[model samples]
Target: MVGRSVTAVCLAAAVSGAAAWAGTQTQLPRAKALAFGGRPVAAQRHRQRQPSARPGVGVSMNVHEHHHDSGERYYGPASKPILDAVKSPADMKRLNLSELKQLANELRWETLEAVSKTGGHLGSSLGVIELTVALHYVYAAPEDRIVWDVSHQVYPHKILTGRRHRMHTLRQSGGISGFAKRSESEYDCFGAGHSSTSISAALGMSVGK
Candidate 1:
């Protein structure tokens, strides 16, 4: 009887340990999700299980690693036919929603290609790709005065506003200034390098206008 009882306890302990191990393995992805922004574990699991609508269409968020090693630059086209057609913000206004989406992808690729060679504030520029497209599409620059704070983020804006050709000369001594400059282009209404200055500049422009 004692032998039987001992064996049963051992079996129960083994089962419990196995269950715990399995649970830990399942929770690993959720743990990674929490590291991003403390999202709930269940939501993370649900996202993991969900499939992407279009496979192989996702653009990599990471900056190109080749820029670190290669001396040769990427001089090829930044995007497909959609982006190639966009010469100015007025051109963007003509695009439908689907075309605009395609243009955004192209703009992103172009921005990456330019920055990969010249080396500028790539992250901020990339983060605002969609916003830059949207703003240019909706509002008229040079006239509307779309003042940008931390103008490091304005690479995409520059690309949309007829500065794509000069992107290769970015941040050089005689090249384009990395930050917003009214003299550089009329699209850059306010020139600022610090943060929290856009609101004041916008207000000043509003009053001045």
Candidate 2:
């Protein structure tokens, strides 16, 4: 399948990149380190400004926290999950192709688990699971500027970029945003809810540079 091939290529590339940067961690070519006046821009400004329901509490993907008459819902791993080791994109480089594939599976499960409760865009996010994993794993984010068309397609992106803990609170009052928000995370370079805006935004970011 085309999707399977793509994932394989991405994993292979990630392995190569990781090996290249093994001795001394070097920035990926596309990665532009977050720099403003030669200092790291505030990473969690949005969280600091607007706190979520359970700050610092990791979300459990295995089961539904809410009780329903139907039954308890279970999603990903019960213990020692691949996703548990991945708090950010950088954490993905160490995983082999098999592990990367497993991570993608877990990431998909996490996305479904979060969106099922919060009620946001799901199809688009699911569609790009492998792509998101590849992008984050292959390139450096916040600096690399991986813009998504119709920002709702970033749930998996959010999960990979240090927002997994707040995923359960998504789209709620005082919670993480449904669509991308620049203040929400450095990884979200451009924020747009509607379609066909990603090209323009990418152009502007490129031209500005």
Highest-TM-score candidate: 2
Where is the poorest 10-residue window by lDDT in model 1?
1-10
lDDT of each: 0.65, 0.66
lDDT for residue 168 in candidate 2, whole number 0-100? 92
The clash count of every prediction, one per candidate, is 0, 0
lDDT of 1 by residue, 1-209 (tens): 01111111122223354344223222113233243234344454556677776986543322222322345333435337987788888888788877877777678778877887899898677666666776677666555567676778888888888888999999987999899898998777778784667666666655554
lDDT of 2 at 96: 88
Q: Model 1 — TM-score against the truth?
A: 0.64
